[model samples]
Target chain A: MNNRMILAAVAAALVAAAAPAAQAKDWTHVKVGIEGAFPPWNALDPQGNLTGLDVDLIKDLCTRAKVECDLQAGEWSAMIPSLNAGKFDLIMTLGINEKRKQVVDFTVPYASGVASFIVEKDGPLAKMPMTGEKLDLNDKEKADPVMKSIGEMLSGKAVGVVQSTSHEQLITAYFGKDVTLRTYKNSGERDLDLKAGRIDAGFDSGVYGATLPSKPGNEDLTIVGPQLKGAMLATEVAIGMRKGETELKEKLDAAIKSAAADGVIKTLSVKWSKLDLTPTF
Target chain B: MDFPFLYETFLTLIAALPLTLQLAATAIAFGAILALGLALCRISGILPLDWFARLYIFIFRGSPLLVQIFLIYYGLGQFREVRHSMFWFILRDPYWCAVIALMLNTAAYAAEIIRGGLLSVPHGQVEAARSCGMSPFMVFRRITLPLAVRQALPAYSNEMISMVKATSLASIITIMEVTGVAAKLISETFRAIEVFVVAGFIYLAINFVLTRLVAFVEYRLSPHMRQPAPLSAATVAGEIR
Candidate 1:
């Protein structure tokens, strides 16, 4: 063959060899990624297998979706990158947000969430206004007063958070100038500082926050202030995958919808978090 | 290339560079002093002192720097005595806690470097200094210290660069160093590769300048090792005349 024709034929052969892998994707076999350290949602058992709400729910969703899925536990920071790199077909417990949307598409939210503060039980911050109350941040009229009061109280105080979380954004948006912010790589690391009194308070998800006090030796930590949702804080979490994986997304979306309708999420939520995390709509 | 994003991230990250430099400088400076004492302990013929220094070096070098940082920052405060003690004011601050950890960790490694430098000073040179009517202190001050420092500078410079990199760990405790800001940016943007590339460049630039400065110091210190400067043409002509 002439040189030009030879090059064209080689390129065509390469494309032909790649097209089947792209076009004939199978949904029956799937791989799911999850963060095993985020408690109540997911964590490793003593025997070192992943367990908890996300694990249990994923099993339900995969059954309903009719996919025999293999679950992988990994670092939270690696989730989006790994999924887009094709290491995973889905990532669990990803809170839906605008920034993440640019990189990975999300399944329908399967769990509703909230944010709150935890402080040493003996600290003055433990007596914050609206303790044991629910404050919907979207209702600015009611939230504004409480937000102002919490801000003023926390002024010049250091607050700790796990970096990059939705509640971290909410804390910066509401109390950026008021509180000294300390971002950590993970919750366990941040919790140590909070216990040491290096940080005056810690902001975390309500699921995480409410559960902290009950952990042994965390008796001195009290979850105070309102369970907060809306604004920069994400109120719902979902499975995420690369954008345009339409077939897999549809399969997950349908499974999640049915799981919610059948009360699977509510049952798992109460079992794991000791609270109802069922998404409203 | 997202030049704008990189430029903005650089600005944000550079704002924290002063803190990074401060952490490294304080740790290196204080660590040098501690390391000198530890090195002397090893060379001093006293058995107890030598063993103490050996034990100190072994403990610090064996453990991870991150664990040491956490222990000093958080582990110490666990006891009520630490909180109530007069030293609590310094221990309570994250900045000081990081400095203490970095200093202690560097001292262990730098001690060996200093010890090697000190040992390399020939016994004949010391005897010569002593015979020159110089007092013991004067001999060490004028001859031994200078030669030992020159011997140590190359290895010590590596320790200093590593110390600079170690300052990134201070971010875990809330000091707004370069790595801390880069981490926050990554979390906000979810653009790990881009932000990481920018952060890596910043460290490379810092260490580049640091390496050059160390080379300059070594050049000045080892003037005897340099080839003599070439005479100008007029000077050569005068010599010929």
Candidate 2:
């Protein structure tokens, strides 16, 4: 009897010690939201599956952090609100900007890109000087001349841009009353309008603009204006979380930092965007 | 309460009101004519005409307005034949595409309303008119048309107000109306609630004025139903004495 009691106490102690270890190995499943509409960063493939640089990077980051991730696609306008409402744990491919930072916490940037204009190959504005120049919109002196020339060239012409993007802001602020600004909900619609000759020009990311001319049936389209960066057009794109989610934000930041250092982001960027968009930091 | 910001946003949104009103006005005007024609076809007693009218109404009424707008704007543009055709000129512009979609959608609902009105015209009245030696055209002009229009006015007014609100969907296809400008403002300020509030008030004001105008027209058209003015207190007292 005495021997049996001693054995039973030892077994209970062993079981208690192993229970916590089992719990520690349990994975934390995170629900991630992504706008699978923007190409090269995030977009739906021909099979209706999410495939892009952001998708690849997020999967890698989640794997490295050992967190089980459930990725879902959402509309761009509803992303931040849904994140705040606890619909998702994090939003991938969010462009870091001052206005957005006021509402959500951001991880370290994973990629950066510039914005530009796409126009018909033989369009009126296509002949404008500064076809491939990189203009820093933050510099008024340098940006003003480009703005003046673009304004004169595009006056009374209809320009299409995605709504709620820096592209719309840039056109509205610079062109003002000189041009008719049409705002679309997504890039695909704007691209359609551009191809159909409904709009004289369309504004989008330089990476996307560069890819358009090469697309089958898009031979008439070409990047016509300067590659715009800085100012309202944010350079860095990162994952966004609801404010006060320090633990998740920290984990995401670390994962992104490691991914950048290990060249994972660079590999994905080159594969998707045909350029290295790995942020320096 | 951020009155200044609201005022500023209101001013910005107001600038786009003309586009909204223009879309609504154009769609409503064209839709009314199409509705009348469809209603006539439905009542014409011809099998093919009635079937065509039924199919047109079913397709437009069954689908969502947004889908209709997208199909006309984006989906139609996808076909090479559409792009190369003469209709491309009209289909190419987002504004016209939106108007065409809205007009078609509204016409479907309006045709049903007008059809109900036409049916509601008393058969006895038509028989009486025919017995009195009135010609078919004369009877239709003097009796059927007037009574049908009056019967349809109340429902038609509701459709008109809805058409005004539907104009906001045009923004999805890149037409900058009041809602489009509000969306742009929200994007810039990141104050979605405030910008939308101002936009709501602008729409309310427009609809309020429109409602009153519709009510006045309804009152004017139904003069035979108006009641005599009530007696004043002095007149009542004098009558009692």
Candidate 3:
């Protein structure tokens, strides 16, 4: 037992003593990352504080779950990577989509809005065929022809969508080069640019587009295109957790179900979305 | 090492070359004029002009270009009055807004460079010109401006290169330059490394050509420095001159 050997033993003892405490430490303080640019999901208010439906919903969920939640701002493109890198514990602005599920696990849906698109009310694409219809994207046999015609009509026209979003994939997969795709980093920019006439069309959630024109001065834009749903789009929106996060996912799923059963989700959806977006489940 | 794919990516990036060139050329050309005005104001002996120039330079140079781009494109864009005002036409296009931001940013730095060049022109030479009956404007035009331009070329050329790289930030505001195209490609393909590799090579090539252009200008302008090495009779004879 020379001096170096004694120091090594002391370090080993310290680690051995600290292991239990480390295991016992509660991860009650949860960090939720939301995109401040995405409205009706999360957005920055004039005071530079995060607000919107997701912001409100996350706070409510955290209160019920008894977790100390610290909501943080993040950009959409960087959200998942930041979660994977441990910058935040969960991503909340995300709607549950299969492509995302391939990389991350999502809790049972908390709230859901239909997959929707918007065009200028009086624009050439205003008379797009799927008006007042919700096409099931899973049925390609029915969807293909309609999507093709729509794509052809929108030929040489620009569609603005968020990067890494299902809307981007949907427009690109169906239209390919027939339509010029502009992928924004988030919904606010896409909406702003669409209103500015930089883009001919924009796509996201029905609820988000519903909220855009109500912003202080953006009164001219209207959500006038097809309201799309299913397969290519997720049927519901859910909280995104890291893959293999079974314990966290299970806890969240249970919380979501309880929130739904108690009608907490419905009330919040109607309050924020201005329509009933409650999951049937 | 996928030659076909790499070749395709190269073609796609080259397709964006016109926009990249347009941004850099437009910004630098306008930036030079603005830089001249700013440099003159800093030396104009007017207290307010000098202070305003100092403040403008301090703020633009002190902040990151990305932050400034966002402040102009997104931050000020948040205001309803800004959206409705006459300035909206200029601020409406992301391309023009990007050019304005890049030009203003470059001018701030270039102004300082030009000011240094002007200050370095020998005072005795200007005094001698004045004593020889040259007007103040003539003294500046004959002795000051040319010398300052020659002195400023090296730093000014560096600023030009900086503007070329700075144009990449325009992608954030949705102007589809090389990086924006690369981002869209990667999002669709999910091949970040492959797309960025091709994009990086395009940037490298652009910078390389720009470096050559600057070197050519430097060589041509400093003709006295490039004159055939004293034209020794032995060397001339060897060369059959």
What lDDT score goes with residue A254 in model 1? 93
Q: Estimate each model's TM-score.
A: 0.90, 0.84, 0.77
Predicted candidate 1 versus true structure: per-residue lDDT over A1-281, tens digit per residue: 89977877886787457432434477788999988887888888899899989999999999999999999988776677778667888998888877778878899999998888989999989889998888988899999999999999999999998776777888888988888888876677788778877899998878987788788877888889998887767668989987778898899889999999999999999999988888866
Clash pairs (backbone) in predicted model 2? none
Can you tell me which runs of candidate 3 are displaced by over 4 Å? A1-29, A46-49, A59-68, A120-125, B1-18, B40-92, B123-143, B182-216, B223-235, B238-241
The CAPRI category of model 3 is: incorrect
lDDT of 2 at B122: 100
Q: Can you tell me which runs of candidate 1 are displaced by over 4 Å?
A: A1-24, B228-241
For model 3, how does the per-residue alpha-carbon lDDT over B1-241 read when each residue is reduced to its tens digit?
4456678877887888789889999999998899999999999999999999999999989999998888887766677688798999888778898998999999999999999999999999899999999999999899998889888988888898899989999988888899888887665554456788999988888889998998898887778776566787898899995
lDDT of 1 at A72: 93
Cα error of candidate 3 at position B119, Å: 3.7
Model 1 DockQ vs. reference: 0.38
Q: List the residue pairs that clash in candidate 3.
A: none
What are the root-mean-square deviations of the candidates from the true structure over C-alphas?
5.2, 11.4, 8.2
Candidate 2, residues B61-104: lDDT per residue as tens digits?
A: 99999999988888998888999999998998778999999999
Error of 2 at A185 (Å): 0.9
DockQ per candidate:
0.38, 0.30, 0.20
